[model samples]
Target: MSLLSPKVPALNDPVLVNEWMAVATAADISKPTRVSVLGEDLVVWRSSTGVHAFRDLCIHRGTALSLGKVSDDQLVCPYHGWHFNGEGQCTLIPAQPNMPIPTKAKAFSYPCEEKYGLIWVSLGSPAHGVPEFMEADDQAFHTIICGPYIVNAEAPRVIENFLDVSHLMWVHEGFLGVPEHSVIPEYHVHEREGKLVTDTITVFQPDPDGRGKDVNNDYVYQVLRPLTVQFTKTDDQGSDVFAIMLHTTPLAHRKTMAYAVLTRNYGFELDDKQFSDFQDKIFSQDETILLSQRPEELPLDLAAELHIKSDRLAIAYRKWLRDLGVEVGVA
Candidate 1:
């Protein structure tokens, strides 16, 4: 949170501060918009320079700049009509044009950039660039950006749910898996290039691709960042493949919004809306179960939750969170 707003929870965790989080889609910010990440309210907007992110509060009166408008590539303060340029420096003080603007009289700005149809912001200097999505660069794949599915639970829980295959048989019945074929094959997970990558874990899916065929689906999971994870699902012959990148934004302590970037080799014949709706159904199922989880926050202590053979991925995820010293969304 900003020092100006001491009442808000602090988001100064070293790991989280230096990491970039997706605050909005590139299409969502034509005008000044308010978005929360790690408990700080930021106003994200697009200017001639590029996408800009700054504290939502105007220094003059602490009014939310998001309530204001943009003109001539500058953000206008809603209360005093102060004009701030894309660099976040106060350029014009409507009432006192002759006075010199104080160096401190500026909107608190942060580093921001646009990539993969999303606007990413870092409250502090970024440790590294955004996670990689190889399929996004491949021309053979059709890519679609999905939801910012707002969930009531914290981010880690939502991410862990995405990494979990155990719930497929029950929660996603008939879509991803069925109880009759609930058995999970052994898989391997290890660290590679600062990421947790998993070997193929095969599961039986009743109707995975909407073709209504029962087939064994092989999955490989990777944790690219503390809050970003992905999985690649393929057929036995590796002729067909689907990959999804899951990015979660911590809106607040117990609130998070998840976005998915889906790329598939097949499905070119299907409408993009159909693929979006299909994911909407899958996420909706997880949302229900996630909301019902107790304590809201994910327990960093492994002993707090029971683990089984299939939970190895989740176990590694929790360890990763703990190792990073992330304190925002875990116990």
Candidate 2:
């Protein structure tokens, strides 16, 4: 089947779009990590000097380079004694004692950067820099790094959920969402700098019942392509907004490895333990639903079939992708 057919988007192709991959925690060749972005197998690891990313497959025998070892800032293939450096250059060859290793034996390389406790890889030429923690510099609030999660759905679908606010009453009722008795919220969608930003604000009037008191909250989501989302929540008493940024890199046509960072801005004492606990609860809730979704891309021309006021954000997002010259599947 064609890659971009109605049933599936061309997620594997390198020309589609770029995505963020993983975080850099430690430096050891014995610890090899595999990441999939744009349907390509990316092998990320730390050498003695810094981090490096290369195509996972070895050039000589086609063994996974990620399964190899790191020795003296060079990746040594486990199958054959071929060594490659950070620039994907073949530096050493055990079989050839006198002959210099041919350049053809080198592996394919990708651009990777280590920042904000994460390792980011670019599948395409990304003009915008790697996603940063905006709240980290604010002294009024503490910052936390919420570890990554692997979601089953596509990156766009996962981001749509973060942009959705109407679902709060039903999906996250008891935990973070308002009750059914609360007034329905007002929503607005805007575009800024080739990106779509959504804001949903609801004010909780003084209610006779205490259940609806905390319903007065505002949720704002900013979608920054090719896969970064910022979620902010503001309220009356000492505003606390957490920015959940997601970087989804495609593993295949049906799977993705999603790297997420939750940056919190609480104008009070918020320690690591408290922030970690909060993130754990919220992410655990989201994981259950996202992982259960059908492992397939939604029809590209969904606008022709279903239409709703709440779908405005979804439509705008699809349009933004289309505007970037990405091929939207046929109806």
Largest TM-score belongs to which candidate?
A: 1
- Backbone collision tally, model 1: 0
> Candidate 1 residues 90-201, lDDT tens each?
9999898999987777888888998888999988878799888998779899898999899888999999999998889999899899999888888878999999998889
TM-score for each of the candidates: 0.93, 0.79
> Worst lDDT window (10 residues) for model 1?
1-10
- When summed lDDT is taken over every stretch of 10 residues in candidate 2, the lowest stretch is 1-10
Q: At residue 134, give the lDDT of candidate 1.
A: 90
Clashes of 2: 2
What are the C-alpha RMSDs, in order, of all predicted structures? 2.2, 5.6
Top-lDDT structure, candidate number: 1
Per-residue alpha-carbon lDDT of model 2 for 87-188, expressed as tens digits? 988898888868977758777777788765677777556666776556655565454456555666666666656666556655566656556534445566
